[model samples]
Target: MPGQLQIAVLPSTNPRLGIVFALYPSTELSSPEVASMGMTLPSVPRTHELPPVPPDAPFIARERLLSLDVFRGLTVAGMLLVNNPGTWSHIFPPLEHAEWNGWTPTDLIFPFFLFIAGITTHLSLSSRRARGDSERAIRDQIIRRGALIFLFGFLVNGFPYFAWANVAGIPDPTFLQRVLDRLMHWRIMGVLQRIGIAYMVAALLTRKTTLRQQVVILASLLFGYWIVMTALPVPGEGTIGALLLDRAPRTMEAWVDRVVLDWTRFGMGNHIWVGGVTWDPEGILSTIPAIATAMLGNLAGRWIGQRRPLTERLSGLFAGGALAMMIGLMWNWVFPINKSLWTSSYVVFTAGLACISLATIMWIVDFQKVRGWTRPAVIYGVNPIVAFVGSGVMARCIYSIIKVPYDGKRVAIQSAIYQAGYASWLSPRLASLAFALSFVLLWYVILSLLHKRGIILKV
Candidate 1:
């Protein structure tokens, strides 16, 4: 197949000669090969020495940005910390999600990951296109990956389907009935499911469009969502006022989720929020703006990929982030920055924060060449899919699947451990924090070993 190709020269004992040639296909060069070549492959683009190409070069060869991986590692670490507290009931304020409108530090993790997914989508797709991958091949990959991610999430949600020992005098049902119940009540939407949808949409939108067109599409999504959410009258509310009409069960977003997902089918109703409202925070309507979040990340990826000075790129990122924040805050006056709604304002605000955070990390880690403290984060970053899926399954096992005898009654193994190990002496909040920290450390150790062995589970 015809495509753009790059050959990298490796150092040899003889200064004048190259020992090996590293071939990078447009899609992705495996980490082991990159490590062997002694190059730190960041998600950002870097200059390369290549043979002269004709005017119609099908691909662009670029260096990876180290900062992107560091940023991803930091985000995943934050996810583990917030998600695995000793007791969800006793979590620190920062670790807990905001009730409805405002956002906490905890809220940032999911959006940040989605944003990163968008950035990587652009990088990976561009590489494949340059490798002469057919349009059909690329589309199939995007759809298949998205589907697998969603399916993984669904399986995780229904993990360890039923406990053999019954509780509360409830009669034991047949095994087939148990399976049926799990399938019927399983959550249709969740963190990974939303990510899958957002990533797929963002990839398709940016696949062919120019930067100018992407910007226009992004603006339209945000503005269009704001109008639909605020101007349209909610079913029960009977009238539309942005403030009065935009709360949990009364909002249009929730109504759509209920109608499409059906409250009766799931029996549990909407499970995304704290209240018993029949609405998911990551519902169908809100996913529209979430796509904008990824699109914004795609824009950042493109900017970073440009052949420009690092200083110039950093400046552009910071300046763009500040501008986005200002616009987001301005929009928030009318459409409050509600994470539940995934409001247009919230998308702009969170994306702005992501850009600024990434730029700072780039400045310190990439430009300043700080290497000592980055190893842990880099380890976590390279194997993010592993960390996320593994940690999630482990948490579910601790929280629900395993039960232990406690004070003459069966209790969740996690609770028993918390009560006996940490909560016995420490205060509630402190105990919770300690447990969360321990979870993060455990995952770090696992990820570190994987990194040392040059194993990365790419999804």
Candidate 2:
């Protein structure tokens, strides 16, 4: 699940400063793996081709790509930076999400991770096939992993639900009612949830298909989504008016979210939180295009894993990325390139950017063999699930779970720390940036230690 970090404010004793600092985790760290919670295991070899092994044999490891790790690490670091601002309200323009349309550096993070997942999926599956695993065995592994990833997202979404009563300072509450409330309004789809869904679908689609077939599927998904979103008449709206799509609740995406994940069926209405009404950016309809995003990654993975020369691989990636960006921009004339919608244009544009970004990293890290500066990103990249999940949980605990008394009132520990430790010395935006940077640095230290200890937490 994309970790949703909510920021709350505390009343301060100082009369001059009305809102001293915002506290808590900011927003979703939606990724496949949660941090530090997975069991320690030996590092998997980068590449391997063992003799035919029994079906019951432990899954053979594939060659781990340093560029992929570094790319993933860079994405995770960006996730942390954008998510853990000192004060959510006072963030730099680049870090904040666009109001409704357009894109930001922050918007690229999720898709980049998804792209990496696609690449890794191809590499991993191919490695298993090389080791003589049957199609059934590989398919089972995909299903199991996908289900577990979805389950993890669900758990994170509902984390500490029971403890809400305590956090809210409710002395006593009807236990059953609390449980019912939590269950009734739980968010069904999120960052990790989307990843799991896209991963499963893309993996299955690419599992048996050739590159040409995969490309066809990708095109079909994007075009189909565009047509549905733009042409189909929304239930209540008179005609298929583009203007009607202005409000999120009026769009087809929100309608599907209502029908599929509607809380009213459970006697609640405000269960999900895209626009906090009826829409979710990571809702079902948007996931169609998201799957295309993953497929694009799969194509890239296939290209990278081919027996071609390094220059050829990089050239193909760069050319593909440029072409995708051009096509996306052309489509943006009609589609407007919105991230929340995960519009066809958005998918291609973001995926294009991801490709170029990854290619640049690969060129430097792999082609040039200049790897010294990649250590930080590699560390975060190697343990993304841990970094994302751990940071998210920690932020939630600091913001919501743990409380500290300040000026005769209990305040969130995050706010208190931010105000005293950061806001005291820095401006609000700088302080927020500092806090976020500190969070990233802290995780680097933790992940670096894990890397040193050979503790990889792969799902």
Candidate 3:
């Protein structure tokens, strides 16, 4: 019984219900503790290492991968942890985004999510094809789903749809005018927007292409982006893009963001990132390499879908990932591994790390058959959009939208909570970490309930 896998059937929105398996020490599948651990599959670490099956034994024709779910859950959990610290002013170095170039642990999270998106795209499309779905149906689904995701991101950007609570120069203005002002200044691109765009383009591009053809397309994207970024001149700046890289606002990407997204000439004001009015981290030109990152994951998914032994697949992933890391590092010397730019080197490097991380998780959960501790991640992974959108909206309300009287002055609810509950007794850094951990735990409770009810939100 020690090495035997335990199976649990859960309802799913997909026609194929999700079948999950875990290796437990006993056969008490219905125990309260076991029931608490829920995961959905549609669907991590250091050694750079890494299932087929019988019918009714977890791997049916539309079997789900527990490891993929676990990996995605972990990434989403990490996003929540990093994004919701008690105070951004006091945080650990690794948890923080690199100021400009290079990467910290935080930098890897977005690319990891995108890479996983690419893998699932491949797996999902394959499953649909196996079910006798026509290519036209598949294409329509891709476009519709991709558009919906982008719409969700767009909506989140302009959430609450309310006027600013405070404006420096404006006296009390009409509510309609204030609302219009907010609309005019709403941001146009962000993490989810970029993810939707990259996933849609990468999926469509690889939908009908052969393995060799996908590789060629990937190569063109990375190399072509590198050439454009390093060789092309910034129109009015009269300088190559590479030369302007250090000056964030002067880069070609920033120029494009300003030109297309900023509507000041038409009185709509800027729609780029509020942090950088002239630029956006998830800018247009940089997305070319982001697509490459997703395609790399598509290639890995193809490899996993092969009929080879598990060991063979593991070896392929490890070897290929290591080779990619080396190549990306070599490329980094020229382009720099920049998260903001989503540079060519950053794409390859992060995708390689994603491969290695997923391979490691597979080895643990699948090859070794040890997954008892994977439930929290599984919960977060299954309903990522809910976590992302819900958390984003909640943060806005608590951090800025709602306020309370504090020290005879108004302060955001989150700030009041931090000052009272966390900052009162703990060091600044400790308090920040505690608040973030608490936020993660709170979401875990919410997601676990949904997971228990077999409710998964899929776009």
Candidate 4:
């Protein structure tokens, strides 16, 4: 890693600049160290306009739009794939969550999505600024995008608004109580909701403030989260981090979620959760630092859009990412990087990975011009929502209402499919992965049609 750090690093110019490309020595950068930095090498181009490639980026999808789309698509794909496994009974290590602390590939999905969001936001806003779009317009766009995303999340959660039946076939709760419970049990703060809020806040912050100011905001939010999680005494002193884990009263996020979230939906408090605070993973206060995740991404986006050489931009991103990650890791020794908490360390770790990943994509798509292998991913990348929605609809239909006919009993379609194809040929892990990919392809066909027809269902 030390040797890699010396592999022709470059400094980034100030915030408001343009893009460039430069050649440099190859280097190998990986993990805890990787977490600390903007990103590690493996180059990709930012624009379609660039020099011919001699040493292309390996495994990275080239094509600026495609890179972003794929990163986004991958995130969406990952969410669906992870959320929809053939059998939770036997999941691959990468698909599982960390026990108490530590991370796996699954943990990277959310932050990676957020990272791409930040990158896309920065790139889009910068271009608009260049095209004479007023600051007011850009701000308006951000707000609009944010609001729409928020609305969509709410709508999605609100769908199929009925729970499993009670005794005598009666519904467990009344509509009013259910609605109230949405806030009470509504599982307040979720994947899309977080994305919406984070995007809006981060966009405004980035657009309105200076880069230095943005950096300050990022640090403050992360530090603030750490302070609150640790310094605040548990209300009545049961357990420290526990209060922040579930629907506990002392936790600031739970209180806010109770007020702001759909009570009927997210309010159960985990079955045995006993945290003093009961923090919803996507609860209100937690979103503050989530904005920092996007900010780092925007900075990277701004840097990628800069006029410096491609190598230079990649170098700077890696350096800055490295520094942030290092700072986060050191902080983790004290605060710990808890994704559920969205702690400062988590931010640092995720943000560093984001930069490094983006740099790799830039190297491949933009620099190397080798996009052949990325076609399948690119297909999935084009329409993320289609993939998400299709998976959602299909899963519910097959796994629930549309049962498969089996030995005199109704069987889940998913189970039947797995038994017929996946089980028959591949190993469980391979079978599960294959199902996930096929699921992606099923949606890809629809998205490809939409893309061909220019019918994007934008938020």
Top-lDDT candidate index: 3
Query: What is the TM-score of candidate 4?
Result: 0.75
Name the candidate that leads on TM-score: 3
Tell me, what's the RMSD of every candidate? 6.4, 10.4, 8.0, 11.4
User: Which 10 successive residues of model 4 have the least lDDT summed?
Assistant: 16-25
Tens digits of lDDT, candidate 3, 19-105: 222211111222221211222332221221112222321121232346777888899999999999999999999999999989999
Worst lDDT run of 10 residues, candidate 2, spans: 19-28
| Candidate 2: tens digits of C-alpha lDDT, residues 1-459 | 112222223233321111111000111111111110111122334242223333332221222245766787788899999988888889999999888888889989888878877876775666556546689877876776677667767788877665364423346767766676677667878888888889888999999998889989999999999888888898887777366556778888888877888768666744676255678888889999998988888888787877677788899999999999999999998987888889999999989998999899889976887877876776676566677678888888887778999768888899899999999999999999999999999999997766665454445
- In candidate 4, what are the lDDT values of residues 1-459, reduced to their tens digit? 211112122223321011111001011222211111222122233442233311222112122334554455556667777877777676788887665466777888888877777876665555445335688766766776676666656655544444322322335667655554333333434667788888888878888788889888887887787767766655454656434543345554555544564333464433111132344566777788888888777777777656567778778877877887787778777766767667778888888877777667757865676666665555555445446556666786676646778767778888888878886788988888788767766676775565444343344
Best-first order by lDDT? 3, 1, 2, 4
**C-alpha lDDT of residue 52 in model 1:** 35
Model 1 is weakest, by summed lDDT over 10 consecutive residues, at 16-25
**Alpha-carbon RMSD, candidate 4:** 11.4
Which residue segments of model 2 deviate by more than 4 Å? 1-64, 163-172, 265-270
Score candidate 1 by lDDT: 0.72
Enumerate clash totals for all models, in the order shown.
8, 22, 3, 56
